[model samples]
Target chain A: MKILVTVAEVATVDDEFEIDGTEIADQYLNADLNEWDDYAIEEAVQLQEGGVADEVVTVTIGPEESEQTIRQALAKGADRAIRVWDESLEGVDLLDVRAKTEILKAVVAEEEPDLILSGVQTGDDSWMATGVSLAESLDFQWSAVVNDLDHDLEDGTASVRRELEGGVEELSEVDLPAVLTIQTGINEPRYASLRGIRQAQRKPLDAKTLDDIGVDAGVVDGSLELTDMYEPESESDATVWEGSAEETAGELAEMLREKGVTA
Target chain B: MTDVLAIADHRRGELRPVSYELATAGRELADETGGDLHLAVISGAVDEFGEKLAREGVDVVHTVADGEEFNHDVYVQAIEQLVDTIDPQYVLVPNSVNGLDYAPAVAGRLDLSIVTDVVDLAVDGDSLIATREMYGGKVETTTELDAGTALATIREGEWPEAEGTADASIEAFDAEIDEDAVGSTVTGFEEVAGGDVDISEADLLVSIGRGIEEEENLDLIRDLVDALDATLSSSRPIVDNGWLPANRQVGQSGKVVTPDVYIAIGISGAVQHVAGMKGSDTIVAINTDPNAPIMDIADYAIHDDLFDVVPALIEEFQ
Candidate 1:
């Protein structure tokens, strides 16, 4: 089985940051592989190591600067990488789920992998819908928020543990030519070793344009438009305990005593 | 038609509370659009769900009796047929794990614009503006959808549940479900958090988060918990990192804890984490970043590093 994982480079804002129009100011933004995708990549890599997957390929829809993040995936274990970008995508403020699904669907058609893995949601946008939407569009079976995936694929069925709300997990089986949105805690993502980082430098990282991928630039022109961005007004009327660590601790202890909490 | 169609969510024979909230949201939008609010109660005990959902603001309850549990394929087909029949302008679904499983497929199949996890919504002329959070609750954003037909998944706790009884028209619609398209089977559900500790039963909870930094640092929190005679709990990341067990996790997917006091240390207080602990009588946040979302709901906040403050707090009790 050939496994394909969708990887995204997400931007995390600093604790104290400035919003430039509809985005966070550039200086306060830090780019890294999305938290959920990190686990997905590890799951795919482990499947390959177990011989259940013949190859593990990663696809990312990001700009050239995202190569650093893509290499992180390759350094860990993916065989190669494919990145799709275009000038048409540069102007888009918010890349809606459909636009992403369309771009990834085109890639899936080209790759023809037996199974696909995507994060349940991106850290930045958190659409939490793309993987299932992609599966539906491609006519593939899918399971969302999967925390565990069984490696035995002899019957072309993926037994997964879907992490439901309120401490419950649903055990389900999805037929192959399937997509599973990987949830965190499925596996521990390994750090890139010195040898793996060296090998990643020589690995294949191919870039494709929208034209090359057989997707129209108009896909970026979706009906969704990001019109406003602002910090939510703080609802806190918190009594800030300001002092040295000792002084603050003293205040907290007094409050606990007053409330009869430290009896 | 300018009508709004909302889907009621259910699991394991009980209707989720978000279903009623969806009704409230659907009614609000329908009123703005000058149309009726139609609620679709699918699967399980359809008649039971429909009768219970026939509350004020719900003009119609369309029930489809299909599978015993939530099957995405069943949902996609039922919703498609309903859309074809009702032609509602907007379809609202709960921004839930199950809703994540199907809402996008419905939108894709129907060729409608889709948005998820929206906290607020408003209808302005021909456009619908959805307010949502991004960058882990650091900022809020508004996205305007001008698409002809749109589907949105609403955040669970954002809207109030529908109240008062209304004489809503309840009707059954038979949907053509393709058996071949249903490729997944839900075997059973396991409660993974059932162990020695139940955080929900705790009184004073000392919850730690990503700010604890290292596993060795957990001893600091443990010491404080021991000193205060409090139960120890944590945000999802600590459990995800394997530093803690599933039972200790406090979040949407874990335990919903309402303690006498919730002392959040280094936790940024994401919406999911907040959902689980916001009901605490007193919220105290101790973190280096004063602007963390936890501080917003905190009754008392100490803007200091947990490393320095936790040891001091423990000493105070000693």
Candidate 2:
């Protein structure tokens, strides 16, 4: 069985990070593997390690630095990595849901893996629809926000339990070659050990552009655009307590008492 | 005139509260864009849901009785037909699990500009701008659709629930879905859980976050819990790390707790996490970051490390 895991590099910026022209301030922008994708990678690697699958391939649509994010996945035990990058994709506004989804669709057409894993959402877009949209466009059987997943290689099907709001969970099954959006906390992601990190340096890290992947550059049009970004209006007026830890705790306990929280 | 179409979401033949919430939010979008509000519903039987939509002040309920349950292809096909029939400038959907599952598919098939989990919506000139929280709700981004026909999923709890007036029209639309397009079969749902600990009922919750540092540090928190006689709970990090059970998780995906006292230690209040516990009578935050979002909702926020605050709090309570 071959499992395809898609990951993306997300920006880590301060709460006050402001948009400078079309993009945010450069100084506050730094990149890391999307936090939610770590769970996807970990699930894929665990499935592979448990002998439930023969291979685990990770893919991403990102810049040159994204190869590093792919390497982090490999360090956690992915067999290889594929990076989809184009100079035109460098523009912040160019790569929208359509562009990203189309890119993944193209890659999936090439891989033809039995199963696909994607993060439920991203810290950047927080859109919560890319994985679902990609699966839909590909016409693949799919499930989303899955917290528990188990596969049967012999039967060529997988059953998953999805986490829902208010502590409800939905259980369903899909045939093999399906896409599943993995929810976080299904399992703890492992750190890259010294050997794994060193081995990742030598693993196959393939980079493909739009033309190389047979995707047109016109998907940027009719895409969702970030017209502006700013902080939301403050809805609270919290009182800050300033004192030593000892005094502060006493004050908090007293306040809780006043509010009838505890006596 | 342009209109915004909202699809009512239902589970097990029952309409969800977010069904009205999305309609409420969509009513504003319709009013702002000088468009009427239309609601489309897909279910094997949506008679009850259809009547509710009418009372919610919707201009029309484009009701479709295709599948008793929500099938991916059924919803995708139905919403596609509804969009074509209405030609609404904006398609507003709820951000529930079932809603997110097929909303994207319809948006993709219709080639509409899709936005998921939007908290705010506005009309800037001819463009439709949307605001959504990101980075765990620490940052707010205002995004716009480059085209006219756009799709968005309204975040639940961000908008008010639609009030009912029982005065609206209903329309029936048929979705042409090929039987072959239904790729997967539902083999009945198995309730994998029940009888587990329900943390939402806890009177006092002593919650910890990444600032707890390690699993061993839970002992320090345990001491405080013992002093305050509070139930031990945590945000996603501790729960993800297996330091706490999944039921103990207090966040959007977890249980919503309205404890009398919620002492959040080291938890940076992400919007998702706050959604579950903002109703607590007293919320105390202990974190080094003075600007943590949790601090905003906290009645008494201590700008100190958890390691320093937990021990002192335990002693004070004792």
Candidate 3:
């Protein structure tokens, strides 16, 4: 079985950062492999190592600058990589789920992999809908927020544990040619070794445009438009203990005592 | 048609709290659009759920009696047909786990604009303005969908539940579900976090998060937990890192803990984490970042490094 994992290079903002219009300031922003996609890549790589998957390929919808982050996935054991970008995709404040679905669906037509894996959501947008939207667009079976998977796919079925709210898990079986949105903690993502990093440089990393993938630029006109961005007004009226660590600790200790919390 | 159709969510045999909240949101939007509010309760005791959801301001309840549980294919098909039948301008859904499973599919199938995890909503003329968080709640953004008609998933706990029964009409709408399209089957639900200790039962809980840093530092937290005679709990990251078991995880996907005192150390109080433990009597935060989301909700806080403060805090109790 060929497993295709959807990866993204998400932006991380500094704890103390300024929002320059609808975007964060360049100095305070850093790009890295999406934390959730890191797990999805790991799961796909492990399936290949366990002999359930014949090949593990990664697809990313990012700009040219994100190749370094995409190579991180290749370094972690994905066979190759595809980076989708075009001039039409630039300057769009927010790429809604449907636009992404249309773009990924075009790639799916070419790859035609047996299974697809994507992170539950991206760290930046957190739309949490692209994977399932892509599945619907392609008419593929899908399971969301999956935390566990049984690698035995001899019967062309994927058994998964869908993590629900309040500590409940739903065990389900999805037929083959399915899309599974991987949740974190399913497996530990391995760090790229020296050998893997060298190999990644030699691996195939193809950059495709919307035209190259047979997707129309009109799809870039996503329905959603980001109008405003700002730091949420803090509603905090918290009593902050000040001074040195010792003084703050003393103040907190006194409060705990007032609450009758005994040591 | 300017009507608003909202889908209700349920698991096992009971309607989740978000269903009533959806009713409230649907009614609000319906009022804004000068349209009636239509609620759809699909699958799993729909008749009972339909009646239960027929609250004040709800104009109609349409139930599709189908499978015993939530099946995305069933929901997608049912919602598609319902939209065709009612021709509503907006479809509201709960932004819960099950909501994530089907809302996007419905949006893609119908080619409607979709927004998820929205905290607030308003209808302005022909556009829908949605307020949502970005970068894990660090910044808020308002997105406008000028498409006029779209599907949006409202976050749980954002709106109050609709109360007081109404004389709203309840009807059964037949939804043609294709068995061939239903490719997934839910075997059963297993309640996790079953272990020696239940953090929900503890009075004083000391919760740690990513701020704990290295695995070796967990020992310092363990020491503090012992010193205060408080139970040990943690945010999702700590449990995700395998430093603590799922049983000790205090967050939306874990356990809803209402302890007497919740001392959050090194935790950034993500929305999911706050959902689980915000009901605690006393909330304390110890983090170096004063602007961490946890500080906003904390009753008392100490904006200091956990390494410097935790050891000193432990010394106080000892």
Per DockQ, the best of the predicted structures is 3
Q: After superposition, how far is residue B35 of candidate 1 from its true place, in Å?
A: 0.7
Cα lDDT tens digits, model 1, B153-196, are: 99999999999889999999999998888999999999999889
Score each candidate by Cα lDDT.
Answer: 0.94, 0.81, 0.93
Clash count, one per candidate: 0, 3, 0
Q: Which candidate wins on lDDT?
A: 1
Candidate 3's residue-wise lDDT over B168-268, tens digit each?
A: 99999998999988999999999999999999999999999998889999999999999999999999988888888999999999999999899999999
State the displacement of the C-alpha of residue A50, model 1, in Å, after optimal TM-score superposition. Answer: 0.5
Where does candidate 3 clash, by residue pair? none
Runs in model 3 with CA error above 4 Å?
none
Candidate ranking (DockQ, best to worst) = 3, 1, 2
Docking class of 1: high
**TM-score for each predicted model, relative to the true structure:** 0.99, 0.95, 0.99
- A1-263 per-residue lDDT for model 2 (tens digits): 89899998898877456667656677877889998899999999988888898999999988887788889999999999899888777775525677778989999999988889999888776778888889888878788888888745568777788777766777776776788888888888999999999999999999998899898877655456766666656665777788998988888878867766553
Chain A structural similarity (TM-score) per candidate? 0.98, 0.94, 0.98
Q: List the residue pairs that clash in candidate 1.
A: none
